[model samples]
Target: MGSVNAISKPTPVNPRLSSLPGESFPVCIIGLGLIGGSLMRDLAAAGWPVFGWNRSAHTVKVANRSGFDVSGDLDATLRRAEAEKALVVLGVPMPALPRMLEAIAQHAPSVGFTDVTSVKAEVHELVEQHGLTDRFVGGHPMAGTANSGWDATMSGLFDGAVWVITYDNAKNRGQRGARLWLDTWRRTVQMAEAVGAAVVPTVARRHDSAVARISHLPHVLAEALAVTGDMGGPLSLTLAATSFRDGTRVAGTEPELVRAMCENNREALVKALDEALALLQKAREDIASPGQDLHRLATEGHAARMRFEARAGRKVKDAPRRPIIRVQPGAPGWTDQLSSAESMGAQIGIF
Candidate 1:
């Protein structure tokens, strides 16, 4: 639970790493659950060898049985990655990141590393503390369902997803290494494209805040809805429909992870909740008044939801095609222009 110096934007991939041959590298994924197992399937299908390990022997056996190269020994897993010059992806929960990074630093110092933790600030700090900044990148793929475990994983999970990458661009020591990292990202992006996800850029703080509004807050609200709707009445429970179930679906997530993420990002989440509460209070007041613009809130919410659904549908249909507008150098006020363009559905290249 340490602090990481916040990075403002996505760093450009190191030219050096990009210059390497288009050869595949072995990848070691720890924790053969949803994220890890999905990664293993995609990478293996892409012609890259994948090794995996999990705390549960049954999970490891399942991965192996499913034709993945898996082992139960942590050191053995690291050794395999070291022998193959591969990146070890830590796909476990946030609480396990520090210990996993420590283990990697001590046992497999030379291997490149990354992770799939939703919250990155703490994990980034842990990697820095281990002096492995040059060899690691913090990653979070913005895709998942209310599911867990190796059995639940699929190859198409990350298709067209925004995979956030956070790193120390200020320090130029890993420029060449960063390129390789991006090459790996290109593969991930391709997978996302294949699966109907749109690649987007976001820093750790921005990601946390945005997710708090759309993802985290929904979970909290859903749980609240479920609790308020049913007070031990079978009739109330039986009356639930698709809309009600969909609205409260995320409430089914592991409570411990929900608690951890909420506690870690409490500040941003609190602000989001407060804003939502204010809007709700205003709506209630307006509804009770003689001449209040209650319809304005309804209109805004309807418009927003429509826009979101439209964008989601477009992203799914356009997954196979590369972004149309690549951000180029020498454009006047290119940064602002590109941002504006992207907001309007133009796909700008990631620099």
Candidate 2:
């Protein structure tokens, strides 16, 4: 693995220093994929100026046409961000994080940065090793569709989603700069609220474990289902129903990205799979027995699913403050929707 070299350390200023109210900050997004593009849309709609960069010129062009200020040159984007004292959002893959940090330290040292990568521990270590800890935060927006790329982005993608922010104990030690961070948090919360997702706070390890169970495990299960059905005759597959289709939905994900996430988070995923297998084995054993309490187990599974749904619904309702921006039944013009939100005292971010 490549390592980042340490640079000169800055004086230990209080990390918890307060932020001024209504202060506008420039944001630099390094990727124009689904998450980055959606973030840009939300930030721009909320009236924040944004600068975007992508490895592909075509991606940048598409973002520019969609009303984002995109730069094809990485150096130029860094220069622009340094000039504006911006917050840089890294939306690259896990394996790309070390090099990205090195590049940022070399070209954009003055800008504060954050990443949207799913796995946090390794990336967090890289940021610290590069002596950019204070100026960086780990962000993982818990929202996305099965789609990828800028063209798949929608302004409401993050609405009502939990965007996890992770840091070392150092960053959250005081309440001083908590408000400034909260301003950024508030913007993200509003974005989630607008999209219909609930915001939840969690530590990195916790986030990884939870997602491994709910998200990663499901992808694995979907792949297993798809593979099993492949062994069946074509006629059998033709008779698959809605539940079969839905259950195997994520099996169609981009192969590379899915493989990367699974490999990177293998430990947590393995543990989750073990637990799931144990439960399945118990169910199987019960079904094999003539006098098995099949009804009880079925009831237990149903009750568990109901509890999960209820908790998820309650969390969504409790996460955000009142006065959320509501979208009508039909798709309206972007400007008109934004204007409506602004009039209702809702902060909206559009990229």
**What TM-scores do the predictions have?**
0.77, 0.75
Give the Cα lDDT of each candidate. Answer: 0.66, 0.66
Worst 10 residues of 1 by lDDT: 10-19
lDDT of 2 by residue, 1-351 (tens): 122221132211111111222334678889878898888887676556678898888888777787689988887788788788777889877777777888888888766677888877667678769876656656778778878888888876765566665533224423544433433443433333433444344445666777789888998999999888877879769998898899898998998878988887787899999998988888898989988857867898899999677546333434444233433211345335534543443433323
For model 2, the superposed segments whose C-alpha errors exceed 4 Å read: 1-23, 169-197, 313-351
Q: Residues 112-187, candidate 1: write the lDDT tens digits.
A: 7778887766666777787777666667777777678887899767665665654332135466655555444444
For model 2 the TM-score comes to 0.75
Root-mean-square deviation per candidate: 9.2, 12.8
Cα distance off (Å), candidate 1, residue 8: 44
